[model samples]
Target: MARPQRFDTNQLLDAAVRLAAAAGPAAVTMSAVATEVGAPSGSVYHRFPRRTALLAEVWLRTVESFQQGYLETIEARADAREAGCAAARQVVAWSRAHPREAALLLYGAQDFARAEWSQEHIQRADRGNRRVHAALASLAAALGADGPQATERAVLAMVDLPLSLVRRHLRAGDPLPAHAEDLAEECTAALLGSLPMAPSVSGSRH
Candidate 1:
């Protein structure tokens, strides 16, 4: 008889993500994950008791991946103004690369998920939002769109428009509509075009 095996949580989680990506979240079950990870069902149960918990974990992991990559993209921008534009473009690109994650997110981020959302998930989302907000704020300032305080409309306008358009492309199994650059430029211009160019902060050497 084979010895009872141990399951690595990371491995389990990784398998769960892949399963969900390939077969949708419904395909993620303890038995399914156990088979995918080559572990016993008992070992899988030792880690995740309920399907909801497992699904949530998978969704959370996807969210973390998105949050990390997203911030990195915006942070790479030379200025907030550029960050805004970059953010829009990055969002489209990210959506294309991770359609499964994006679909999972769209379903789970609805207001109804509040009842089941874990605090860790909430905190992670809040942190991600702050990064997004800050980047948007910076863009607004750079564009001279700041009115008394930060106007997030630019960020909202920029990302939301592109994301929705990209979502359509994913829905029909079609490629992302138009080149990323062309779509990004059109959205950025329409959203941030009104803001004045930031006056050069000359002599303010860090």
Candidate 2:
């Protein structure tokens, strides 16, 4: 029987995530990840093939992990307004729980040399983005604010705003406050409340 592998793909990616979070994407070299995990460089190379693949995996894994929870949060609530608020709150809560991963996400994909990523990696990133946009569009329609402007507002209220809150604290290396979730939910509620309701269609009586 073959001996089980000691180091796996996720373990190496986790090390890369930590390296990127602590310094920047530039710090996530294959040798650096191998050293961080105390694994042989061959292990890292075997999994990633090159530094570009390693960087792509690091960014994609973190983002996919985050989006899974975020999408679930939005879907869990029956009420669109409440769902939007919960989604916002989830952002802060997730960041608080996974500060290192959150820090890594603070940098854009471009910072991870996204231009060098493979076609498969680019497709993976695009699919995640499309899923997020579709979810926000559904939320906007449920809230009776399905116009382009309203959908944009929904994205801001539920996604961008909460990320900004996390970004500030993560960039400063300060722990997110206990009230961060509440603050995020409150801000989302406010923005969602201000959306212009779509006009109702009525049948004319002959």
Candidate 3:
């Protein structure tokens, strides 16, 4: 009988991601992943002793890559205010472009039963989310959108608009049509317009 070869960590992880996307995380067992990747189950067990290890790797890979893109996009903006607006726009574009990745992250992150992550891993997750947050805060101040309350106003206002729109296009099983830009523009305008204008003239009479 021929001996079996071990699968590399990346290949196993890729299989895990694929399995999760297709059948959710429950399908990501060593046996299933090995079958998915055409390898022996022993190889997966050798690489990841516990199932949590594999899940963590999959979550970390997805979130970290996304965080990098968000950081780059936010940092590249010339104006903090524009950066904030662009951040919302970029999220819509990203969600539209990479809906599966978004879905996986949403599903993975929500499971509180997941393992305790490493400090470095936790920091990476924070860094990914904080890009949009910091940019939004800076932009809000720069554009007179808010002072301390982000969730009730700016964050709430912008996030759901794009997310809901993305969900609609996705559930319909259709690519974002060309006319989608019109909807995006209208959403962007409504969100930006709804922000409270700066306190009028600071010292002017009411």
Candidate 4:
């Protein structure tokens, strides 16, 4: 039987994430990841062809993980207000659970050298973004948001506000308080509530 490989892809990526979180993307090197995990450089190279590829994988992995849970929260709720609040709460929950990965995400894609990314990487990022917009649009429709500013308002409530809450704690390297989730949910609800809902034909309340 063939000998099993000493290192797996996840191990390398996890190490890279730690480096990126602690010292930024520039700190994530092939040798550094190998050293971080005590693996041979050849093992790291086997999974990732270049430094850019390694960094890209690190970003893609972290973002996709976050998007998966956020999308699920939105999809499972029929009430737009409830779903929007849940989505906001999910941001804090995911960040608290994955502080290292979440910290890395605070660094913009440009910090990861998006200009050098492969077409596949670019496409994957675009797809994830499109999905987020679609989910937000659905929530906006359900919330009775109408008119030209509807989409913009939905994005601010569902994306910007919640992320700002999480980002404040993550950037400070502080643990999110027990009440942080509740605060995020409340803020999201309030923001969405402030927007004008579509006029009901029968003048029914939302």
TM-score of each: 0.74, 0.92, 0.74, 0.92
User: Which numbered prediction scores highest in lDDT against the true structure?
Assistant: 2
> Which sections of candidate 1 miss by over 4 Å?
1-11, 18-27, 35-38, 110-114, 147-152, 201-206
Task: Write the residue-wise lDDT of candidate 1 on 1-206 in tens digits.
Answer: 98755677878988877776566666778899999988888888787776666666677677778777767876676665566676777777777787777656555543224446677767766787787677556656666775853365675656777777776766666767558656775777676766666776222111
**Alpha carbon lDDT of each predicted model:** 0.68, 0.88, 0.64, 0.86
**Candidate 2 root-mean-square deviation in Å:** 4.5
> Which is the winner by TM-score between candidate 3 and candidate 4?
4
The whole-model C-alpha lDDT of candidate 3 against the native structure comes to 0.64
- For residues 65-161, write the lDDT of model 2, one tens digit per residue: 9999999998777677778899999999989889999999899999988999999999999999999888877777776676788878888999999
Clashes of 2: 0
Cα error, candidate 4, residue 40 (Å)? 1.0
Q: What's the CA error at residue 170 for candidate 4, in Å? A: 1.7
State the TM-score for model 2: 0.92
| Steric clash pairs (candidate 1) | none
